[model samples]
Target chain A: MSCRPHWISPRWMISALSLCLLVLAVTALMLGPAALSVRQVCQACCHAVRGQAEYDPVTRIVLTTRLPRILLAMTVGAGLAMSGLAAQTLLRNSLASPYVIGVSNGAAVGAVAAMFLVGKWIPFGAVPVLSAASGLMVTATVFLFAQRGRNFGHSLLLTGIAISAFCSALTAGALYLAGERLQTLVFWLMGGLWQATWSDVLIMLPLMSICLIGMLLLAPAMNVALAGQRSARDLGVNVRRLQSLLLFFLAVTTAVAVSRTGVIGFVGLIVPHLLRLTIGADHRGLVPASALGGALLLLTADTIARTAAAPVEIPVGILTALVGAPTFLWMLQYRAGGRAGV
Target chain B: MILRAEGVRFGYHIDQPVLRGITLELCPGRVTALLGPNGCGKSTLLRCLNTSLRPQGGRILLDDRDVMAMAPREIARHIAVVPQDTPTDVPFTVRQMIMLGRYAHWDTWGQEIADDRCVIQRCLERMDITSLAGRLFSELSGGERQRVILARALAQQGTVLLLDEPTSHLDIAHQLEFYRMVRELATEGQAVLMVCHDIFVAPMFVDVAILMVDGNLLSCGSADKVLSEQNIAAAYGVRAQISRTGEASFQAQFK
Candidate 1:
């Protein structure tokens, strides 16, 4: 809508976005307090690949510190972006995001509590598991509320809002209770890949891949659904089943990412909208494009978050919201043309 | 395709049945006009005929196979429905919108084939919306949207076409054109059942007329025979005289 060069193809846009992602990945690997050169990063990666023992500082830094953090950032960004695309498609609302389902707020509650309570060795593993469970439970609650009415989308949105608000209140209560480790709790809530490890990467990578491929497969079905639920049903689509599968994939994807990385908000909201504008609204292309766009966005934001200030690392969530909110608003204002009237 | 509904009964709530003891069949090579007053469950019956709604008390058969037992894609491969209103604010080209009609024609992983492209081109041409093919769906006017919807349904290439209030948004000329298209489609062996309100003009285009009142089927026969003065009055609660509008068409004048 905003005067894009129509000659610029969506395929080119996606390729460019991927290239940027790769470039950013390289740049992010080399940037830190102990600024490794490109050569150091490559040598460390090669050494790790060959299964060399890592008494070396460079391999430890690259493999354990930057690489997992980058991988985690990419997965989380991609997962949330795909979830947003799924939500927007299923709800038939351009403004809808994965967070509209309230799962992240539930994860916030689970994570905030897990971060503070049970002092001695509840295990770091409890955070993501507890968070994911609570997030899923909240979604189940929203689904239960949606089942009471005929207009499932309307009911789901309203119920998701109510539950999310309630969860935010619960999270606020936990924050208030954390008197000693309050700063650490606030930092976690602000969200970052500051604590990324190989375990986190291993946990999220497979799920992200599966969701990406699943969303790609469901893209055409989602296109039919954009015509409205009843009409989609009339066209021989199993609307109920499609809705359930979409909700499940998106909800699980967002819940896991939020469990691991706290609540990073705008990757979901901005990535789909941005890619929809660039790649057009055909979900067949938009789903994969969104994954690339989101990875690029969050990876860039994380790189800036850590390196912007010399010593104090800013939360990646803060940077994303700060960047994403304005960019979304600008697109909405300037790109408010007939094609974007939806 | 013969879509047969046997003693179909449906109700949104348990106590209030919108369609009660309805028995009918939509046969190919004939256009069937479902005529009824407001709240007469004509739309509900159309939905039932397609796989959109299940009858609470009766079974709908599609040429000996149970409609309920068939998978959605299987049913969709044979049946195409143009709902009363589809969301048009979606950001898809008219071409892409019509392409969605082929969702049931192929598997989940299947790409758009040569046949799909040919069918889409035919639909676009048939609806006289070829020039609007590359235009955004949200930019179309109401009548244009209606035509696009019709094209999308036709693009399904199904044997059965179910339309509900399709001509509501059309101008008189477009409405006539739409009915003509429906008749032509019926002549091509598509079982066409459309929920229409214009008892006066319907007899001109449709081969059969089924009249209803308060969810009860009053009469169903050849258009001339079923659309009598008495049947018109019974369905609409009005006294009217039937006048021949054309060789095979009739119009009603109030007494």
Candidate 2:
């Protein structure tokens, strides 16, 4: 019955998470096959910024290779986490994530199809675009199907799950047709940050920023929405309009992230839930904290994937699932133990 | 504030109707209990008043203004609803849950300003849940949760408050306490309308009783006039005996 507020308020949580993300970004930039010290990384960055550094191997690796990958990781992680938070709130289900609505599978199908048609006629640059388009198409289908009922959130979750399964099957068939390119296709499906480029970062950054800002602005509506649809309407939330808006933004952000990262999983699901456990469910705090927490989790997992095997690099998705699944299970057990206040 | 519904008609299916041309008015500073058997459209009528369900054929007016033309937020600034048995999965603290009542008043960034915080604190104190402010809403018991929801509705600062089966799940003591709170709310100049099944207890606390049977209002008057033994038997289709327990209190025994 203690009425005292927690000492670590949401503002403090956000600040601490921001600090963690900054430290992780710096650490991620320092790790990789071609190791660079912190000083070397900073000098390379400054040199690149000033356009005065010689074309040294260290500078090239740090600037052209590692930096873009880290930025891509951060953006993709933040975007997916934001989308996941929206999905959870919209559906009123804790297990919901960015991929719950088939965005990742749709992107996978697009990327695999792009790989098939790449050498024939389609250019390589069209992969992310096609991926994003297909992801949106899938989302639209789910949205339309869910809109047919009064219980939109529940129907949406069910439709998304069914479509997600179907899309995965299509992706599998595309992989089967990709006989010669199986290894590369499987690598992409498993997901990695090694292929990130400055172009990927440029494309994803603005899109994620817009969606994230929009979601933050709509955070109060999202909080009211957690009171259930009837209560949401009573609280002056235009439930239908709010659901559509949130679903649209979630689809855009998830599609953009999946198109770039090629089907990374668990970052969305794990980050938001963990932040909810620590910071509570106010979307005002949950959105930004989830963004940073997701970035930290994915970047750390990517770092471990890169350094753990030295030469045979693990797909970052594999590492995240390996860690995330156990953590989620542990959390479920903890909550079941009655200490989680759930 | 006066909320009036004129010839409100609603139905789920094409042929069968849930609410049949119902008309009612709620005035400020009065506690009116909507009492009926199950599936009598008492809940539906409350929904129509709260704008959660739009009646197919009728118009609701708030202060003689068309309610249909008003924005959701504008309607929310006047009428607040407490729904029945709403279970949520989100792990929000009691304070955060109450703060959701201020959503219509929030600015674009939805920041909790000083006045919003003050309102929330006052609501918590009014609902006697200041000590439970830090507890998770999902962790509270049914009675505590009901009070929390009432606190949230109070925080909405609405003049007309509608509750759908507010004490349907509470113990006898909690049920009495809930009606006392409703009476307190009425005395504070808020109009209170509640859908209730406990015909025995409602007559003791509510100033007015609205008896509905099969989507029709059977009686609307003072509790003694509306909740008489014959009216209760007709509304519930059961024999009932009304015995006066005190000068102003009465209890019904079903035979």
Candidate 3:
């Protein structure tokens, strides 16, 4: 075993990573087309003194546009991270994620269908509500399939995969039907924070906060549930009730994330697994750590998406895939080499 | 905590009953070993008692209270169970695993109260595994895992415990150790019901023995009365010689 010390304790690592993320988020807000110095940003934020006295147009842009985008990144990151942690522990599989269970695809299908059918009638904020409803409907369908027998993980995963495939086919059909007016919609599917507004932040903040708090409250029960269904029952846990509550929470959180930032694959899958290696599957630590680490990673990715090509701002989703795929490959190699030592 | 099952009839389908009109009572503060051949419904009966597998027709009374009417968690508060062959895929520390036994005592949030920790400590102490508390259950040997599981039951602080084939994988020393722990728990005023196939050791382990053949109660009484040569032969369909090992100890050999 490698004798690497100091980074082993999860609390220290989480705190260090969270502090670094706060700094990175501030840097993201400060850097844009019209660059504002850190001091200038602080002064502009403070300059909301009586009757809008001499406010910079760049400062207004920072407050309205970039701030909401940063908050969107944080909320989606935290929500996806916590959802991934819950799915992995509940299924007792290292590779389990909200997307692996088809939640993202389900939300995407709902959004695409709603765009095709009801986009003219509904506003932008209403699209997320429709997408969330669709995702939850799919989750309910999968949950019913899971309860028919004793094989919990096997049944749940199989049902999730089946639902994912069905949703993906629907999404593809919608994309094909939307031939000419599909440019912005297709870009949305790839996922970006280009249109993030105060209303979006207003909605996502409370939803993600509630999910995070609820998941933390249920952390102890989730720990018991992770010991497998029968063992959990023998220990006096109501295994069936636990499963229902978890599925509901996971579906809602994942739906919220997908609604905010189209189908951002692999964030949920990778963040929780990396945290598990250090924290050892105790949800008490894993939940909070994954949330922070996820926020940091996406904030950094969004920053690079903005600054990497100054003249042409890249879609944040494309940047995430570009960065995440290589990191995922390296993680796979590390796991194969036994460097993780799990 | 006496367990009484009256006129129990269970079947997967109505056409073929697994347990047919079986009536039995488990005495308080005693270890009762359940003996039966394969496919004879020993595990089914145990499950019925624990309310894991509800009998299609019967009234199971724990301390004369109808088990069917009580909530499962309410029943869990009074009865702890160790199923045969619990699958372990995830690695958990013995402390973390045993802490789950306090679930009935916790609120919806599953808080570990000071009393819960105290009960867990005493359980680990009783099982002589305080040192192994930090060890991962998957990392432990089979014998160690069994003892930790029993400690989890002990932590429930229930009046009755139902175990299914608890010592099947244990060597002779660990087998005796397991039985000794069960006997000690019974002496602490908890009723213990264990299903075991070691007919030879069953006589020495429990105060009473219940013999089952083809889902019917063949015999139920004191160990000496129920472990008779005729009863053994009748239940197993084999000839046997009953020999005395000590002044009060007896063993049966197949002929």
User: In terms of TM-score, which candidate is strongest?
Assistant: 1
* All candidates: TM-score: 0.96, 0.95, 0.90
Chain A fold similarity by TM-score, each prediction: 0.94, 0.94, 0.91
Deviation of model 3 at B36, angstroms: 0.9
- Candidate ranking under DockQ, highest first, comes to 2, 1, 3
**Per-model root-mean-square deviation over C-alphas:** 2.0, 2.1, 3.2
Query: Which window of 10 residues has the lowest lDDT sum in candidate 1 chain B?
Result: B244-253
The per-candidate TM-score of the B chain, in the order shown, comes to 0.95, 0.97, 0.96
lDDT of 1 by residue, A1-342 (tens): 232222236678888988999989999999998998989988998889898737779998888888999999999999999999999987889899899999899888888877765566578678789889889999999998997979989899999999999999998888888898789778778888988998989988999999988988888889889888888887778998899999999989999898888889889988998778766787777888899988899999999999999689889999999999998888777666523434
What candidate 1 gets wrong by more than 4 Å, as runs, is A1-8, A337-341
Question: Distance from true position, residue B142, model 3, in Å?
Answer: 0.9
Tens-digit lDDT track for model 3 on B89-176?
4456788778877777778666678998889898899889998887666567789888888888877778889999999989999998
Candidates 1 onward: DockQ, in order: 0.61, 0.62, 0.36
Q: CA lDDT of B255 in candidate 3? A: 89
Overall lDDT per candidate, in order of appearance? 0.86, 0.86, 0.79
TM-score: the better of candidates 1 and 2: 1
What is the per-residue lDDT of model 3 for residues A112-206, given as tens digits with 9 covering 90 to 100? 87776665787756777788888888888888887785687789999999989999998878778788848856886888767777787887788
